[model samples]
Target: MIDSDGFRPNVGIILANPQGEVLWARRIGQDAWQFPQGGINDRESPEEALFRELGEEVGLSINDVKIIACTRGWLRYRLPRRMVRQHSHPVCVGQKQKWFLLEMLCPDDRVCMDRTSSPEFDGWQWVSYWYPLGQVVSFKRDVYRKALRELAPRLLPMQEPASKHRKEQQVSRRRRQERPEC
Candidate 1:
């Protein structure tokens, strides 16, 4: 479903727990982490693709999570130069995603990364909404921030301004401890 602008039709899933922490997963065979996202087939709507992607990537069924809200329209991001697949038809240089925010009603243990033969992710964790904005691949950082910002009002009221400060402090402290001193 590549559009005329060379963007693929896709769905991005932001599955959050009761505490407002979102699910982040490490891409298979890679350390890069991101929200679960997949292409939307011609036959399926964005919502349908979201459920299918949620199931495929996180072993979650529609019953396991409730859709809280979605971005009003598509949010897009370009692939980094090295990551683009120029040989593919339509020369898809990016993805225009309809981001879906889902509330996970099932227990965290129900998250199974290896549900399919070719899994999209290898591991997962729950992190604050803004965490991925700083940590996701550079090309995606802006889109991630935009999606989280737009859909954030629908999330639980835990993302107070002070919470952002606390998280930043936590990250700074962790980084300081992680670096070796001269």
Candidate 2:
């Protein structure tokens, strides 16, 4: 629900594979990709909303994922001027999200886009932990970056230096491939 600040209460999911790659999904009929997220219902707690959204968006239940950590407080971002709906009740201009970091404990086959009648994503893939920070929509990039940075240490143990370095290098390679050569 929209709050007095003109921001909606929402939960953002950063579902990661054991190797630390985060889940990225393509919106139905759209090329844009993002992490799983949804608005919280008035009666649902952030944690409750997270699990519900996870199941609806990615077909995962509590049994399939382990909640690693969550943000201490809400992290918010404003919609661009053109996106704000001036006529809407509560005048929501953006989202104030409680971000969750979840580890996928089940097999990949467990993820299904059509788990619910209205699917949030059409297709999904696992990407480097830092990839979403730069790849998500510009309006949400700052929040995504902040969320990932804050949760990384918890997801990646300090002893896994070599693995972390490899992941970063892989992410760099993928970014280069996504760009056109000048």
Candidate 3:
């Protein structure tokens, strides 16, 4: 919902695995990618909106994950002028999000991108926790970095003797090489 200040009240999701890899999703019919997020409804609380978004965007249920942490305040970002909606009642300028970090408790196969009739993501892959910090659209990078850094300590990456990030990258590269050109 768009707030009185012109910013939309939204919920952002960072779904990470035990290995500290985050789920990166591809927008349907587009090459761009980002974390799963949705606007919080006027009738719903941020937490309630979070669960609905988790299901609608990532095809996840509240029972499938454990909430590790959440932003105490809204983290905001502005939309580039060209992207702003001029005709809307309350000109929405950007989003103010309540970010959430969740760890998947179920097995990897539990992710169902097609769970919704109109899915938010058509493709998804697990990547390093820091991977998307620079990869998301420029406008949202700062907020993304803030969310990841704030939640990193809780995941305790320093405590792990090894990170599977390298392995995941290698597999991705190999698959890319094996695929035939269109």
Candidate 4:
């Protein structure tokens, strides 16, 4: 719902695998990609919205994941002026989100992007936890950095065997460098 300040209450999901990578989905028909997120319906708590959006967007359920962490409060980002809908009632200027970090318990094959009639994403892949920082739309990058930074500590334990983690980081950096930016 839109708040008095003209921001929509929303929930953002970061679904992480055991390897510490997070789910990155392509916007339905666009080259642009992002984490799964949706607005919180009236009278619904952020946690409720998280799961609902999780199922609707990624085809996952409560049984398929464990809630690892969440932002203490909302992280906000403003919409680029051209994207704002001036004619809408209460006109949302941006979104204020409660970001959630969920650890996937189900197998990878279980993720179904087309589970809903109208899917939000057409394709998906797992990427290094920090990859989205540079890839997300610029307007939301700051909030993404804040949420990922705050929730990252909880994923640290999953990165055990320091030497291996270090090696992975080295490889990840090399690949990221080889890939061209969008």
> Candidates sorted by TM-score, descending order?
4, 2, 1, 3
- Candidate 2: tens digits of C-alpha lDDT, residues 23-142: 999999999999999999989999899999998999989899877778888999999999988887778889999999888999999999898877878999999888877778999998
Candidate 1 positional error at 52, Å: 0.7
Least well predicted 10-residue stretch by lDDT in candidate 4? 173-182
Candidate 4 C-alpha lDDT tens digits along 1-182: 79999999999999999899999999999999999999999999888898899999999999999887788888999999999999999999999999988889999999999889999999999999999999999999999999999888667654445666777776654543342221
Which pairs, if any, clash in model 3? none
What's the TM-score of every candidate structure?
Answer: 0.85, 0.85, 0.84, 0.86
Between candidates 3 and 4, the TM-score winner: 4
What's the true lDDT of residue 103 in model 3? 85
RMSD of 2: 9.4
Q: 179, model 3: CA deviation in Å?
A: 44
lDDT tens digits, residue span 1-182, model 3: 57788999999998989888999999998999999999988789888988999888887899998777787788999999999989988899999998888889889888888887888789999998889987899999999988877767656545434555877656644643352221
Q: Rank the candidates by lDDT, best first.
A: 4, 1, 2, 3
The global Cα lDDT (0 to 1) of model 1 is 0.85
How many backbone clashes does every candidate have? 0, 0, 0, 0
List candidate 3 segments past 4 Å from native.
Answer: 157-182
